[model samples]
Target: MEAVFLIIALALVLMVFAPVAPSDRARTPLRLRLARQLHLWDRYVYHDPQIWYPRD
Candidate 1:
């Protein structure tokens, strides 16, 4: 049926565009993870936007 074909087509499109999972080697250590999170929070979340923009 047309409905079945449409569902299959949508599933195929989503499969092609889905994000791949990070590999084990891509995982960061705990200290680095915490540091990155804190840095982002400080720069973006807790900052005074009128005085600062994010650096590259």
Candidate 2:
């Protein structure tokens, strides 16, 4: 039981501290990706306006 708890704690720490890539093509850590998807980190995450609203 203790070992399982330790493993879970370690995984949580790793996920929280994992690095995120700035570019869309680059891979982002799961935690950060989820935050972005939920709009929790929108200020910190970059969104290219061109991608969302392209001028005709």
Candidate 3:
């Protein structure tokens, strides 16, 4: 149970920093479907980080 919670928490953290924002170019039906699922998952289970982490 603890491991499951940790994995879920990690995914939520990653969602907050989604590497790319899907836009018009990603609007094709297939991509749209994928994006929709991801967005919904983010909405339900995501948590924004308390601090932004710098990237290279």
Candidate 4:
């Protein structure tokens, strides 16, 4: 029972400090590709198209 408790504590500690694995395509500091940047720009602009394209 003590060994099981210790194992669980070790696992919890490891999970707390585990280095993030490199499986995410959206990792930090990722440079935006041209198309992705354009799409992002579109989403941004489209999010409030009226702000940029006012219908005054």
Best by TM-score: 1
Clashes of each: 0, 0, 0, 0
TM-score of each: 0.38, 0.37, 0.36, 0.34
Give one digit per residue, the lDDT tens place, for model 3 in 1-56. 79987886687566555645456455345456556656876765455443244354
lDDT of 2 by residue, 1-56 (tens): 79976875576566566665566666866766656544633542347676467799
For model 4, state the Cα shift of residue 23 in Å: 12
Candidate 4 residues lying further than 4 Å off, grouped into runs, are 21-56
| Residue 39, candidate 1: alpha-carbon lDDT | 70
Worst 10 residues of 4 by lDDT: 26-35
- What lDDT score belongs to each candidate, Candidate 1 first? 0.58, 0.60, 0.60, 0.57
Looking at model 2, the pairs that clash are none
Better of 1 and 2 by TM-score: 1
lDDT, candidate 4, 1-56, per-residue tens: 79976875575555444544467644443233334445655686579878678897
Show where candidate 1 strays beyond 4 Å. 1-21, 24-26, 50-56
The regions of model 3 sitting more than 4 angstroms off are: 20-56
